[model samples]
Target: MLEKHVCVLEGVMVSQDREDFFLLSNCGPKLLEQKGLALGGLGVASINIGLGGKTLVELERPAAYHTTPIFPLIRSDRKRRNKTTYWRRRSCVQDTRIVIAIEPSESDGDELDLPERCRVLKLANSVTYDRMEKSLNQLEKIVLPSSDDTPNDKFLPKLTPLVRVLMGMAQPSEKIPIQELKFFDDTLNASQKEAVRFALECPELPVYMVLQVNTYAHRSDTSTHNHNILERLLALPASQSGTKLKVTRVGHPARVMAHEGVLDATLEVKANRSDQAALAKDVKNELEATLDALSGKGKGAKGKAPRGAERRKMWEEVKALRKEYRQREGGVVRSVLSESQVVLATCHSSGGRQLRDHNFDVVIIDEATQALEAVCWIPIFKAQKLILAGDPMQLPPTILSIDKMKKAKNTGGTPEKSSTTSDKTGGR
Candidate 1:
């Protein structure tokens, strides 16, 4: 017998704006149903705002009316067989897979973090979600990468635990939420945690956590620089094994690490050296100052800080020491390293770490638009399924040509060609 059941993926991209959210939840199901798809919905939330303390918005998506919720879909154990339907937003009609590219109003920045799976198709007033889907249908003729890129080697060796006790610390009154801890815990399964714990405690093997922090603070000299981000990250609370963690700023000169003994640091080689040099020098100096401030807190130092200050200082230093080295050798190299049997870089400046020997199950990239197209291919080669998320409109490729925009705008201009004078002169 044929069966039709409705499954709702609840809390998917929950937006703070109740109005905009209601549109998203209802639009899809209503459209699907009108097309004869066997889907069902209760109603466009039936509640009204009143003078009382409670608001009508609180009554939406009532638990009693809600059916069993579907969790975010993860890649199944089976290998992905087709690229066309590799990541169908939802299954339907045999001809094409539907992808909804919601371009929320610019005012909705704080609404929620859009799910990583939703690709930012474009940024234009007329390029609504439906138009974007149509554009994708036309682009179906193009080729895309396969669903997964997981390599065979998945062995994580043991690590040594650090015996170094933290010098100073201040406890926050508020409890740290489980959600924050879950960020680290959810990455690995039970067996993986056992392996990670083993590796962190193994003194012989170096283990480090990598982080990229973005501070939206403004700077006077550099228009699009993130010196504050580097500064703030240098002050974050972090602790790890005794392995010497190091922080290297992106856009720094390739040879800077070589000079500092933090060799093999990844850097994206782009134009504009003046800016890169300034940013690099700023990052290096900030790191040195942070470390000195942290180390000086416990010991006797002139103009000593109070206990609270000392605790914050120590936390920053521990974090600096726990850094895992990062090389933005562009997207490709990062991708490749993510799935290497043993991670390695060209310069064994960090000892004889080999790239080909390391491997990873997943790879994620932010601010992806700044990277060259080639860099994206590297990780696709090594990762199981690469999650590339970024605002493409924020910053585009530096090498783009004017001709590329010819068809982008709806300008009514026609191309003018030079006419030959051979009509009268018969000149060749």
Candidate 2:
């Protein structure tokens, strides 16, 4: 039998104090499960707008909005009532209540379409299958590079040291020098010190870091007492070679919390100032030289910027080149990996386009057991050293389909959450 999560929302549970606003609460499900209730809801009305305002029909469902909450269908023809105006996804879900978007009042003639003065409140889905699709398309274009030399190329797409170890082709051998810590805590246990030491000494060791990479360094493994390892690493050496370590956390959900905890700060953008670095000045010189060589308006073998349709596209390429020059890394070599330090990001976000721009010194996945293997692969290819920090006892990723969800109850897959290994959490 299909589970019905239907619940009536009225009286104390309902609040409609302002115009064009409708609020409902005392809902059975948690807000997280209902966040995706963006569109395709039937509005209740005076004269049967949908199934005579008697039944709610949900058909041809997409994976995006998986079985949304069953809200009460109340029929009302009152003028003050939000007349049958289904809102596009301008909604917000918080705690037990949801504030659905309401379409603005229309012209007198247009009001007739909202039969019986009632319309479904809905908005288009923002965080949906489309987001994942975009991430996939971007990933596809990136990991596979345009190689002209085929098998003979000296740079064979450069598989990271972490990737080689994962595929069992090699073992990690790179190491980083750790600086002496001025402050020491006697209360801290051996495991904590060991993990901190590992982070400090390992290649892309926790001690050194690049501001351009990630700030989710806050999300570290807690089971092995490494929760404060990142903080401790930052505390140990205030600055490397007179430059302070700069970090900025990224994530929509965690933004407010990070701010409250005093962890949210802009990445050291000034640190990337090309003027101070002198890289931008060099790039500007080279670009001017190139333009001068081709600035004769197609008179010689060297052609000028094109005309018509190709002109805009050609200038766009030039703009991109200029931007790339301004965004060069801090060290001598402009490379896929930053010359400074390690990157720590959540598994899903680690796959983001901007983060994918640079290869990482290290990629640590916290609670690795809870993530899907497919998602884990997204960041796996980007790391020089990979650390999977997880707890075996914790539950794995959720499967939505009923049949598939049932099968997952027994943990039948290879490298199951229950089989978490030392190599996974052996960051220490």
Candidate 3:
């Protein structure tokens, strides 16, 4: 059977929610029909997407709805404002009983509507398309039951005690087999080194490596971690085997250059800003020099009225130069990455898998603990022995911590209602 997954991307406006899910009911009245992968058949999982308003609630018919819940999908303050505006007067369906609660526009907004019992998984919000793709690829190996109680079959393995405790499997960690590398020190040991070397030797596939940087001086500096890691990896001693290593910074300026004729909106705009800044500085210098020269020439002149026209002309010339410079620098950088066989990737770009067709024989990951569980899996699916090297003690993955959630829910208010609800349900 094809592997299945019931991915819960918890953003307020996921891509899946944009489409009408009623389309699926065309084949069967049961939400969990022939194509559904619900386990044990007690309850079924369905794709739920919505914005702030009652319209989305009526449209999605979500399992539940709440006013106090914060949607991750809408990130911008302007968008959040728009959602509130649209939801305020939208008609609510009496039958739907869509509960809408208004709460503070902060992270605490998520607290009010916390599901008493549900697996609340979290993923990195701002990750690269490549890293996200990779994580999905690795997660593809672990089949998730669509419902809490799915019937056992070829697709649904009989739940073991350990599996039962896990509740539901997720990417990166779930996909990593028992024998794969474990959490270890910052530097690789003998076995880790040999495994990396062996995998890199595969002749037919591309060798991929990721260095996840945890320490960021600034938001932008976080992106530079991958580049630094790639540089260090390439500097490592070459193995006896004759496999060439290449590094590509996905979405980097050099990477864009390699792919001729394809223009990325993000990259194009980034290049323009850099060019414009340089052009502005150069023009300013030129204007200052022209002003100094003109002032020196007219230093002792009795009436500098004639010189005023010359100065005006010079100013116009400088202005023209500035305009010309802006135009010349507006184009995108043609090249983004180096020509090496090794690859360096960052958390942002590494969120999804960009390479395909089992191109990489061996995948190396650094700072695996800080990586998104889904993002970490992308490289694993393509490579044989995933060499995950990181310090788990430092930073954890971006996944939601149930411990933190429970603590927050109980700390501020009376936990009686939620606790009683959990007790009745026997805890999820």
Best by TM-score: 2
Q: Write the per-residue lDDT of candidate 1 for residues 1-428, one digit (tens) a residue.
A: 00100000011111112433454456564453443431232222221111110111111122222111111122222245321111111111112222121111221222211212211111111111122222222222122213442233232211111111110122212322232222244656665554444433332222222222333221121211233323433444455654332333332232122332322332222212223334333433443344334334223555353346655655454344322111211233344334323222211111112233333344333344343322333333333323344343443423222232353344756321111010011000
Sort every candidate by lDDT, greatest first.
2, 3, 1
TM-score each candidate: 0.23, 0.40, 0.32
RMSD of 2: 18.0
Model 2 per-residue lDDT tens digits across residues 213-283: 22333333322223234344456445558865544332222122223322322122222332454655466
**On a 0 to 1 TM-score scale, where does candidate 1 land against the true structure?**
0.23
Candidate 3 residues 1-428, lDDT tens each?
Answer: 11222132222113323222333334342432233211111111111111110012222233442221112221123433531111111112222232222211221121221221221111222223333443453343343445543354332223332222223432222232234543334487665565555444433222233332445421223334454554554455545596534444444342222223222222322343443445444544554344334334233544232245765676566446544443443322222211235544443333222333223434566654445444444444444444555544543423233333465477874322111110001000
Question: What global local distance difference test value does model 2 have?
Answer: 0.37
Q: Which 10-residue window of candidate 1 scores lowest in summed lDDT? A: 1-10
Candidates ranked by TM-score = 2, 3, 1
